[model samples]
Structures are given as structure tokens and as C-alpha cells.
Target: MPNRLALKRKSAYLAQLGRCYYCGLPMWQDDLDSFSRAHNIKPSQAKPLKCTAEHLEARQDGGLDTAQNIVAACWSCNQRRHKRKKAPAPDAYLDLVQQRVRKGRWHCAPLLTAFGALFAGHDSGGEATS
Candidate 1:
């Protein structure tokens, strides 16, 4: 599951990338605007997508909602990677995360983390972890 703000921020980041990270093709940020954020690894080539259903590694393991875990990828690149089972290397994932946050979206990441954690019952403002 993803939080609304996180999704919005990701959409914003994808809007900024201008091209898919995987396929290197143009994608649309807003229907009228043409752009893309390609997946670094196609899920079909990578197996992680089998469980997560997304091309992004971080997202495959609950990392997508975490701004520090997502990357700016295009639709085709993302789609090409479907139903495989391994995440990108740590350095690679980190690189993409850094790339996406280059525009100062780091601040938004923490907010998304807190909101997601709270909603998922991981952290409840010190209420207690179940």
C-alpha cells in the first residue's frame, strides 16, 4: 500500500525525470505532457516483480513509498521488468534514490515515511510497535 502524498511526490519526481530510467523512452507526466521514468531493471528480467508487481526494487520490498528507495523510471522500462525475482544492487538502488531526491525532495520523503509507518501500524508516534 502507498500513501497519497508519497504517490503525489513520486509522480512529481517522475514528472521531473523527463524520461524512463529503464527503456530510456519518453513518458507522460500529465497526459498532455510527454515524459517517462524507465525502470532501472525490467521486472520481467528481474524476479522481484513476482511479489511486488512493480519494476522498482525498493518498491518491490516496500521501498517505493520511501523516497529514499524510489527512482525516476519510464513506463515501458518499468513494464518490461515484470515477474522476475531479485532487486537491483544496493549501490544501484541508492544511486537512483539519490538521483530522484537531487531536486530537494528529501524533506518530503521523511514525511511520507512517517505517514506510511503510522498508517501501516509500524510507528504510532511512540504509541508502541506491534
Candidate 2:
């Protein structure tokens, strides 16, 4: 049987339509090997867009693993939030992420140009175009 947290994470991921809640980027749910294979990059380069379950209120802060508290996020976005000395609230972090996304500063240009174009199916700053 799958772990409860994994199930919740997958549920959140599916509900979010496979997009990271913070940066609105498509997240890869597979292992890094598959991600690298699919994207034609090394596993190290595939780390940023990996899917992860984020706790809105961190577990250290007494957050539960309930669906309401969990959200799907990209590895980069998830790591970005928690790496701060004092992590911002989810909504605040979300706003910050959106701003960065709109400005095309969230992920590097190369990642979006190659990895994102193949997986995310959108332009770096906005929607997919013909």
C-alpha cells in the first residue's frame, strides 16, 4: 500500500491538474531518471521540476497531512519557500511566485526553453502558443 502522505500528494497533484500550486508550472511525477530521459537532460538538471507535496502550514508548525493542508508543488518552488530563514505563508509565497512567474524569473531560461517546452507545453512567461 502507498503511504498516506504519498496518496495525499498524488491526490493534490491530480486535483491541481499536474501543475505546481505555487508557480503554476507543470510538475513531473516520475523518478529523476525518467524525467531526465524524457527531457534529454541529466538527472541533476531534472530536479527543479520534480513534483513534491508541500504543506501549507509546515509540519514543524503543527500542520497535519490532510488534503486541505497539502498541495502539489515543483521541487524548485517547494525548496524556494522552505529555504528562507522564516518561510513565508503559503498565500504570500504564492503571490511572490506568481510575480516571479509573470516576470519569467522563476525558472532559468534554459530550463523553460528546453524542459518546459517539452513537458510544461507553455511559453516561459505565459500560455502555450501555436
- Candidate 2 C-alpha lDDT tens digits along 8-88: 999988887777888776678867787678767667766788889999999999999999999899989999999999999
> Taking the tens digit of each residue's C-alpha lDDT, what string does model 1 give over 18-85?
33333222234343211111333332322211211122444545554544445455443344334236
TM-score, each model?
Answer: 0.36, 0.79
Residue-level error in angstroms, candidate 1, position 8: 5.2
TM-score of candidate 1 on Cα atoms, chains taken together: 0.36
What is the lDDT for 76 in model 1? 33
Per-candidate Cα RMSD to the true structure, in Å, reads 15.1, 4.0
lDDT by candidate, in order shown = 0.37, 0.79
Q: TM-score for model 2?
A: 0.79
Q: Which stretches in model 1 have alpha-carbon errors above 4 Å?
A: 1-16, 32-55, 60-64, 85-130
